[model samples]
Target: MSEAFVKGCEGLPWWRGAVIYQVYPRSFRDSNGDGIGDLAGITEKMEHIASLGCDGLWVSPFFTSPMADFGYDVADYRGVDPIFGDLGDFDAMVARAHDLGLKVIIDQVYSHTSIEHAWFEESRQSRDNAKADWYVWADPKPDGSPPNNWQSVFGGPSWTWDARRGQYYLHNFLKEQPDLNVHHPEVQEALLQVARFWLDRGVDGFRLDALNFAMHDRALTDNPPVAEPKQRTRSFDFQHHYHNQSQPELIGFIERIAEVMNGYGARFTLAEVGGEQAAREMKEFTHGQDRLNSAYGFDYLYADKLTPQLVREAIASWPGEEGEGWPSWAFSNHDAPRFASRWWGEEERPRAVKTALALLMCLKGNAILYQGEELGLPQAEVAYEDLQDPEAIANWPLTLGRDGARTPMTWTDSACAGFGSTDSWLPIAGPHRAMHVAAQEADAESILHWTRKVIALRNAHEALRCGEVEVIDEGGDLLAFERRHAGHRIACYFNLTAAPLALPEVSGSVLLATGDVAPDQRELAAFSALIVETQ
Candidate 1:
């Protein structure tokens, strides 16, 4: 649990104050030239992840599925999808990651399953089957409409009629993905067993996906309309999601999951929480010792801009007080637009990207780095004809498709960006092809190398890793904060605007700085960041 670094320190949990790399399986790398990344591909790139100084890697789902929602809809919890390779492949990948001293965390979607899952199949067969109550099945209203006013996240009604059962089944996502009856004791036990299965298979942890949707109000009450209806293209955004999700009962199920994970020893569990009540729900989900270790919200992932106020508010939400859960920060991920694309202009991207990465490492929580973020890869321009996200396809020009952010990783300057011999499933951006790993590896001043340096600096300093944070300034265009642990103190300052800002008078030794920012400088240049160790 501990690694020797600075003097006077204790061993910390592997996940505490660690940086985790996120890999979207279908886009990270392709093995066998299948145009889709697989387990073997990720295994081959394990060295690259380890080289980044991240403590671990979180791999998105690769379970048995028909790809209805691209692997988020699981068909079998125990089986591996043929396209991504088999159990043997997964085991080999885990072994390789362990050999590199990296933890492996896999996504677990407990809230729902594919319609093709055995349990869902049996549940839909008849009302008297062994697994009849395995899924959420409700009868229609008087006029044969859906039982309630709940809406699916992918758009339209949350219910789909099954002719054989003569009832409507709840699906928070696509109709092909049916919500599970997690409130049932048997269902809870079944999910716990699934957790144990993976733990036994040597997975270091699990990232619970859409955990707030795990349970619904048993009464099936209609969700009331929002107080002020904002312009929204999707029906799901019109109502307050009171009855459909975020039930208090979800804590009970989370405890059950905790019990299973605790038995395995030192296993990490994090939840992917979203929606309006995300802050409260995230705290609740990881509130106590018998709950999840950490949970991340969409604070930065979906933000329109990265400002000092946003960072301050987000960090304040989880203040590391008594009983408060640890927070994990992610600037970019599979579901959100790349941070570089979301927050900066094309001309200022280089400095802005480096500043953001340094700030993320300096924050007082675990940091999550998306697959291509170290290379400063922007959102790919996926044409409407090539779009593959169901939500983006359904919503069209209204919503920027996630396909733009999930493009295949750029491995080389070759055609197809060396992702595979064949064309990638998602087109590699023309600009991204030029920012390939091979080119960056050859350039000493590339963002990839800067990323490694910042991560290493964080690892070397206890004050930055697991310290108490004190916000000094969070005013417009400038953010200043201090990280304190033991007798070591470090200060971080960021210039979040395009104009120069005079540095506050301070005395310290320069530790790390981005964009020509130095301790001797009196003012920070546009989009610059400075980190220093105060004596």
Candidate 2:
């Protein structure tokens, strides 16, 4: 039994302070040599996930799709796309994960469905069909233009014209993804059935994608503009997004979702909520009884720098209270640039890697560690011709998009980098290959080892897992905090800068230390993180 398990969470669940590794299925592993990763491929590589010591794995969407928005635009909720494999393959993968002691959380896209989905196809046929009102259909304004001034996240207006219905249908993302009429009771029942299908298939939980966008304001209203410090790269960034998403009706759907999952025992539910109103939305979506178990924000995902203030604000947002919900933290994921490249310059990345890993482990909430983070993989350079992500293609020279960070995982130093024998879907260049898992597994000083140590430390201490967090200092280069669980006090400190920091007077037995830390003389080198026990 883990020392961290010495005392069970007073009233909390296993996922309260767990670590979940995200697997972007398309680039994880390719078993068929089809240049695309599949469910069978993931099954073949389950050992790597288990070795990470993460409590579970969160796999991205693999539902039948038209490749629009990749798998995010689901064509069918119950079927696995042929490219990823069949339902049998999914069942086998889930069984394999359970055998390896890892919980499986699949992605569920509730906000919208691909234009090719049977529901959408039927919804667009005619206004009088059984499924005609299944999607958000609206009549154009007086000038026969879009219903409102809302913009799609990819580009252009959020409403698409349909000749059959002779009305515009809402699409908050790509035009290929038509927004579902979530307010329809029939739609809610259909979604509940989808959850039941997955739970019966043996999934332990779900990672709801763009959950806030699941419902939209019924009245066709225009969205207001916003003032921002950063230049607006896309049209979606120009507006406040009030009428288009984060509707209050979404909470009721979450309650229904909880009901469906709760019927299946201890199933996990995590919401990927993002927007200008994320702070309030997260609490509303997760707080109190019968809501989502947890929700994550885009705070650290888009952060240009890893400042103490940033960490403090994120932690302070989710204080464990009577009715407050739990928070989930993620530094990197499939949708944004890798944290290493964003936070540290190329020359100083190695030191920053160790410190960042340490910092994430010491946090209070559940940590979502994206695939390949353990190897300290920085964002790979994806040339324009090599980019696969639709977002990058849509916003070309204006933004790097997410293709750079979504490059295929590097597993070896060979030509195919041990991913497969043929050319992969996305490029796996020399830089990524240099930090391959094989090389890191052999090097004691590798970022891989450091990651394992940090995860191990978290598993060995309840104080670091589900403890009550209190910020001691968050100024300059130092970010210090104390975590207390069952009267056991632990102090965690980190230097998130390139210069030395004077160590404060600390009375504790050192549990873990990385970088330059001289306790006797009271000094810590650049990018140092030290953990200790007291009382």
| Among all candidates shown, the one with the greatest lDDT | 1
Clashing pairs in 2: none
| True-structure Cα RMSD, model 2 | 1.4
lDDT of 1 by residue, 315-364 (tens): 78877778988889999899889999999989999889999999999999
TM for candidate 2 is 0.98
Q: Which residue pairs show backbone clashes in model 1?
A: none
Stretches > 4 Å off in candidate 1: 5-9, 517-520
TM match of model 1 to true structure: 0.98
lDDT of 2 by residue, 1-535 (tens): 2434735666566777888999999989998998898899899999888887888899999999999888999999999999999999999999999999889999998889999999998989999999998899999989999988999988789999999889999999999999999999999999999999999999999999999999989997799987772657788888889999988988899999998888988889999999889999999988887998989878899998999899998878877778988888999998888998999999999988988999999998888999989999998888899988788887887664588877888888888998888999988866898899999999999999989899988987888888889999846668999999989999988888888888788876888888544445377778888888876
lDDT of each model, Cα atoms only? 0.91, 0.88
Q: Which 10-residue window of candidate 1 scores lowest in summed lDDT?
A: 1-10
User: What lDDT score is found at residue 238 in candidate 2?
Assistant: 88
